[model samples]
Target: MRQYIVLSDAPWRSVPSRTQQLSARFRGEVLYFEPPGASKRSHRDPGRQVRPNVILYTLPSAGLLPVGGGLARPGGWRRQGAFISRAVLRHGFREPLLWTTCPAQVHLLDHLTYRGLVYDCAADWSRLSPRWEGDLAAAADVVFAASPALADHLSPCSGNIALLPNGVNFPMFCRSDLDPPRELRGIRGPVLGWIGSIDERLDLSPLLRTAREHPRWTFLLVGKVLRNPLLAALQALPNVHFAGRRPMVEIPEYVGCFDVCLDLRRKGQDIYEIVPRRVFEYLSTGKPIVTPLYPGQVEAFPDVIYGAHGPEEYSLLCERALEEDPAWVSQRRKDYGAAAAWSRRVEEVQQILGDIGLA
Candidate 1:
């Protein structure tokens, strides 16, 4: 058994990722810290129990150490690092398998004691500085990237980086035996669905245009919606239903009910290389998908999904996807998700740990 300390950039409330999956595999206990907002200190300290051996807590930031009214002191990097150190010790964590997904958490290296540290580069965090990137790479026993583009991006900081793609829970998502989620039972089909953050990265235009062209087709979007004009437009459309955020356990049932799925990422240099998690999740269900023609999308699902090149064909491709036989499509991509399961991906991570003499 091993003890692990995981510092995360995503809020505890968000969807699961590689960091969470890795922690789940460890036989020992894990103290997982959640990301704080804008350097503010909240009074929360429950350390929510996520699994049998894993607990989660949000850290404090120096910028917002409330002073009853407004009296902020030095809650800078050093102070925040010290705060984190104390928290780690408070949970009886010492010399554990320390991992961080956030490059900004590199500062914790200066204050905490750990047996080994691994930097998993799964996100393109905007606030990360070049100095921290180098610091993290130098300090990390292993640095894993979620994509080929990400591995190349980190090549400047380290020569020894591992390519670790994001994975799905295959059995949970790929099976068609589960009944449709109760929330989706009454919703009309020719149903189109999408799951993940409905943020700016999403190209809402395709959904808007498709819904307008075919009002009878009900579009189900399940995820948190960040403020955007496109979201407002989608909300106004009578055919679109925003299910909001649902529990992770219910996600598979939600996707299982879909006649088809959509992956519409906006065109930009920022996320041109991102292989959205939903793409793999939808693939697990063997549901036919329609997406934008991004390089990553084209490479990952060339034969599996319908890629629309221009705005003129977005709705047309979706219409065509509805014609695909679900059972045939499911069988075609049946083994693909098995190779992309989180368990298989973490097995590789365990080997990395063994190779580095940490196991």
Candidate 2:
């Protein structure tokens, strides 16, 4: 059977990242490795079987060293690399596809061998470790970029980079049968929902002003709110609801409660470069989406998604999304979402591999 060794950035238990989703769909025996644990000691467990063909393993502790650039301490990674090598041999994995998400973990290449290397660039890691990321991309047989911006950024390192944007599990989000989560029951007005990590990347000003302007319209945000001063003011609003992180399975249910979905981005940032994962999920539900006038969104799904300029435009777009969406438009959104499903994304990757003679 074909085999894969995936070096994941996120743990298997966390809300499914791209690595987890793609690995689950790969038709082979997958030996998935999570990032090193906090403890200094190595793990005793062999591995955990998350799926019938996917076995999850956590790398032994790599110490509290800064894991960036080529100058990082080798002692920790050497040990971690040794552990991974042993796992590979124990599982009898021969010439497995090496799929790496983290640039810091590239040191494992020193101790492991693989048929082909696939660098999955989900974000721009240039600031984190330009040297390490550059070397990885340059050495990769194929590079998969999550956005057009990322593809452009990595073009200098590799000539074989492919644009593999974030995708939604279409069937899960497209289900119209889900009942709204209980947390949304008390919301009084049209729900303007947003999901994913609530962090500094968010432009809370639009949400704040919009929430205040429409006191009855609930701005429902469902995710972990990181440290941001603007959140305090948003929390003060009566209509702004912050539902903390829920299980991945429950996201569709929460999204079902939303009348209009939001894709808010911080101002002064390269908003055009970003392709939020939640946008695809929103599209899958056929919900009207209001986001910044990102060229990527406008160009890709011009008819399906609405783009706005400033706070006033943002609010107006939300209102228009709620008021203007027709039944046929909703179906078109669903079709767009289905076209970008993870299954189809994987097929695209397979085709790229075949063209490059790696498959």
lDDT (Cα atoms) of all candidates against the true structure: 0.76, 0.82
Least accurate 10 contiguous residues by lDDT in model 1: 65-74
Q: Write the per-residue lDDT of candidate 1 for residues 166-186, one digit (tens) a residue.
A: 888788898778898777778
Q: Which ten residues in a row have the lowest lDDT in candidate 2?
A: 63-72
List candidate 2 segments past 4 Å from native.
63-68, 266-272, 294-300
**Best-fitting candidate, measured by lDDT?**
2
The local lDDT score (0 to 100) that residue 190 gets in candidate 2 is 88
Cα lDDT over the full model 1 = 0.76
Best by TM-score: 2
Residue pairs clashing in model 1 are 62-75
The reply for model 1, stretches above 4 Å from the true place, is 37-48, 64-75, 87-94, 266-272, 295-298
Model 1 residue 240 lDDT?
91
Give per-model TM-scores: 0.85, 0.92
